[model samples]
Target chain A: MDNYIEIIGFIAAVLTTAAFLPQVYKTWKTKDVSALSLPMLLMFFIGVLGWLIYGVLIDSPSMIFANAITLVSSFLLVYYKIKYQK
Target chain B: MDNYIEIIGFIAAVLTTAAFLPQVYKTWKTKDVSALSLPMLLMFFIGVLGWLIYGVLIDSPSMIFANAITLVSSFLLVYYKIKYQK
Candidate 1:
C-alpha cells in the first residue's frame, strides 16, 4: 500500500513536470506568446522556486526533483514570454 | 525550525496554486488559446489529479489544498483551450 502510494506520487511528479515541456516547445517553435500571461509565468517561477526550497527543507526527493525540472521549464517560458512579446 | 519549514511549504503552495488564476482569467476574458497547448493542459489536469490522490494517501493537507485549487484552474484552462481554440 505504501509502495503504491509512493508510486502515485512519483507518477504525479512526472506528469506535472513533463506537462510543461509541450508548452515550452510550442512557444519556442512558434514564438507566439500572445496567449501566455507574463504574470502567470513570473508567479509560477517564484512559486516553483519556493516549492524547491520547501522540498529541500522537507527532504522529499520527489518534490525536489519535480519542482527543479519545473523551475527550469518555467524559466524558459518566462524568457520566451519576454523575448517574443508583441 | 519545523514551524518555519511548514510555513514555507504553505506559502509555496499558495503561490503556485494562486498563480494559475491570472492565466485562467486571461483565457476566459480574451477567448484566445492559440498559444496554449492542449497536451499541456491535459497532462497537467491528470497530474494534478494524481497529486490530489497522493496528498490523500500521504495525508498532506497542503498538497491536497494546493493541488485541488490548481486542479480547478487547470480544468478551466483546458475548457478555455477547447472553447476558444483559434
Candidate 2:
C-alpha cells in the first residue's frame, strides 16, 4: 500500500511539474503578463516553500522533488511577473 | 515531530489553496483565459487527483483538504479556459 502510494505520489509529482511547461512556454513566447496575477505568483511561491519544508520533514523524496521544481518555476513566474509588468 | 510536520503541511495547504484567489477574481472580472493553458489545467487536474488519492491513503487531513480545493479550482480554471477562448 505504501509503495503504491509512493508510486501515486511520483506520478502526481510528474504531472504537476509537467503542467507548468506549457505555461512557461506560452509566457516565454507571448511575453504577456497581464492575465497573470502577481499576488498569486508570490503566494504560490511561498506555498511551494511550505511544501518543501513539509517534504523535508516527511523525508519523502517525491514530495521534495516535486516541490523543488515547482519552487523554481514559481520563482521564475514571479520574476517574469515582476520583470514584464506593464 | 509529526505535529510540526502536520503544521507545515497545513500551512502549505493554506498557501497553495489561497493562491488561486486573485486568478479567480481576475478571471471572473475579465472572463479572459488566453493566458491560461488548457493542457496545463488538464494535467493539473490529473495531478491533483493523484494527490487526493495519496492524501486519502495517508490520512493526512491537510493534504486531502488542500488538494480538494485545488482540484475544484483547477476544474473551474479548465471550465473557464474552455468557455472563454477568444
Candidate 3:
C-alpha cells in the first residue's frame, strides 16, 4: 500500500535523523573531538542543508523533516568540533 | 526545472555520502578512534540501512545510492572504532 510505503519512509527518516543524537550527546558531554573530522562535519552540514532544499523542492514532508533535524545535529557537531579542538 | 531539482538531490546525496571519506581516510591513516562513539556508529549504520530499504521502496535512485555509500562508510567507521579503540 502507498500508506505503508510512506510509513517506511517515515521510519527511515526517524532512524537516520535520531541516530545523530547519541553523537551530539557524547560530544557535548566529553568534548572529545580528536577523532571527529572537522571537514566531514562541515561537508555533512552543507550536504544535509542541500537535502533540505531538495526536499522542499520535492515537497516531501518526511525528507524535509529528516534533513532539518539532521542539519541541526550535524551543525552542533561542527560547532563542538571547532569549539573543543585542541 | 524538475531536472535541476533532481540534480540538487544528487549533489546533496554526493556531498553527504562523500563527506565520510575524509573521516574514513583519517581513521585509516591514524587509526585514532578515541573520539568516535560506538553507539553513534551503530545507530547510524542501522539508520542508513533503513534509508537504503526505504529508498528501494520509494524507487529513488539518489536515496539508494547515497544511503548505500553511507552505509559502507559508517560500517567501516564502526569496524575501525572497535579495532582501534584503546
Candidate 4:
C-alpha cells in the first residue's frame, strides 16, 4: 500500500505538472496572454509558490518537484500576461 | 520551519483550488465550453484525480482538500464541455 501510494504520488506529480505544459506552450507560441485572466494567473502563481514552500518544509521531493516546475510555468504565464496584455 | 510549511500548504491549497473557480463560473455562466480544449481538460482532470488518490494514500488533508475541490471544478468543466460544446 505504501509503495502504491508513492507510485500514485509520482504519477500525480508527473501528470499535473505536465497538464500545465499545453497552456505554457500555447502562451509561448502565440505570445498572446490576452485570453488568460490576470487575477486567475496571480492566484495560481501565488498558490504554486505556497506549494513550493510547503514542499520545501515537508521535505517531500514529489511536492517539491511538482510545485517547482508548476511555479515556473505559472510564473511565465503571469509574466507574459503582464508584458503582453493590453 | 514545520509550522511555516503547514501554513504554506494551507495557503497553497486555498489558492490553487480557488484558481479553478473562475473558469468553473465562466463555463457555468457563458456555457461556452468551446474555448476549452478537450485534451487539456481531460489531462487536468486525470491529473487532479491522481493527485486526489495520492492525497488519500498519504493521508494529507491539504492535498485531499485541494484536489477534491479541484476535481469537482474540473469535472464540471469537462461535463459542460461535452454537454454544451458544438
- Measured by TM-score, the strongest candidate is 4
| Clash list (residue pairs), candidate 4 | none
Per-candidate iRMSD: 1.5, 0.9, 1.6, 1.4
Error of 2 at A67 (Å): 0.3
User: DockQ of each candidate's interface versus the true one?
Assistant: 0.72, 0.84, 0.65, 0.79
Evaluate model 2: give its lDDT.
0.86
Question: Per-residue lDDT for B7-80 in model 4, tens only?
Answer: 77888999998887988998899998777888888888998998888777767778888999999998998899
RMSD of 4: 1.6
lDDT scores for all predictions? 0.85, 0.86, 0.84, 0.85
Weakest ten-residue segment in model 4 chain B by summed lDDT: B1-10
Between prediction 2 and prediction 4, the one with superior DockQ is: 2
Q: Is the docking of candidate 1 incorrect, acceptable, medium or high quality?
A: medium
User: Can you write out model 2's per-residue Cα lDDT over B35-55, one digit (the tens) per residue?
Assistant: 677887899899999989988
What does the lDDT read for residue A58 in candidate 4?
62
TM-scores of the models, in the given order? 0.84, 0.88, 0.82, 0.92
* TM-score-better candidate, 1 vs 2: 2
Question: After superposing candidate 3, which stretches have Cα over 4 Å from the reference?
Answer: A82-86, B33-39, B81-86
TM-score sort, best first: 4, 2, 1, 3
lDDT of 3 by residue, B1-86 (tens): 98888788898999988887787888899999987778868877887887788778767777888988988888999999999998
Work out candidate 1's RMSD over C-alphas: 2.4
